[model samples]
Target: MDGRRSDTRERIRAVAMELFTERGYEKTSLREIAERLGVTKAALYYHFRTKEDIVASLSDDLRRGIDDIVSWADATPAGPERAQEILTRYGALLHGLGRDMVRFWHENQPAFRELGFGVGLRYQFRVLADLMTAPEHAPLAVFHARQALLALSWSISMMGDLPLDDDECYGAASAIASDILRRM
Candidate 1:
């Protein structure tokens, strides 16, 4: 896509996320998103047919990041070192991707579930946890792995209103997640 077109799509997604955060997915509409972007509904439709399309576009980016991590983990040796690296990479991935999309995913889960985006994310989440507990894949080890990942996930999604900024939230979450892995 041309730079202008790509930029427009990103602007639409960013504004939609802001509205989705401020109002809510169910309460927010394409008309509102268009107004927020100062564009006509027709122009908005040229990029996205519906709010779900906006969300799916964002989700696709996140999924690709996770897929890249999974592919990297597959090549790396599995152990505490690999697990810690996964935690680090996962935290970075979530934070680097833009907190708006992750926050929207957390707040508008019902809409995501309805849109059929949640299943893939949940599956990939489990896969990451399993990757963290590679080789034997013990049940308890997997449990800790999942918890560690949740620290980073929740930090990105649920902690937006905290006094701390993104880097602080991520730093704290990464530390907590590292502790969780240490316990395993």
Candidate 2:
């Protein structure tokens, strides 16, 4: 029973993201999501009462994943190797989570800011950069670290229309990011 319920919820989220992508987040509606899912609005409401709720649910997963990376980095000895691993893990997490969600994030910055999701994520991003440099936290190194992270993130959101497959594009992005990190 629980598994079925969880499946239903995931289905709703998937359909909702599809519709949101097609129609634009602000233009999409709960009715449209339910219609796309072939489910009643009430049934959709049983899982998510509003579009914001759906977005929030997706953001929560991303936040938790980043938090886990931060926790792991905390215990690890920090240096170039740790920073490189952090970039690798961060890219894997973002890419593994789902391209649609990252696309939604890229396209819906205003919505994220409006909902206060950006603050926590921005904080976590800085934390990751800090972890990259640990004790020194040198301004230049941190800047490079942040840029490396951005390369992984922007590759997901901005490179979707490229001819390359996900692995190829992600691999290129990871390489670029690693190069950037090595500069610091």
Pick the lDDT winner. Answer: 1
Give the total clashing residue pairs for model 1: 0
lDDT of 1 by residue, 1-184 (tens): 5999999998998898889889999999999999999999999999999888888899998899999999999999999999999999999999887676778888888998999999999999999999999899999999999999998898878887888888888899999999999988
Q: Model 2's lDDT to the true fold?
A: 0.90
Model 1 spans with C-alpha error above 4 angstroms: none
**Compared with the true structure, what per-residue lDDT tens digits does model 2 show for residues 1-184?**
9999999999988888888777899999999999988989999999999999999999998999999999998889878888989999999998886667788888989999999999999999999999998889999999999999999898877887888777887888899999999988
Which residues of candidate 2, in runs, are more than 4 Å off?
none
> How far out, in Å, is residue 128 in model 1?
0.5
Candidate 1, run of 10 with poorest lDDT = 96-105
What's the lDDT for candidate 1?
0.91
Clashes of each: 0, 0
Residue pairs in candidate 1 whose N, alpha carbon or C atoms collide under 3 angstroms: none
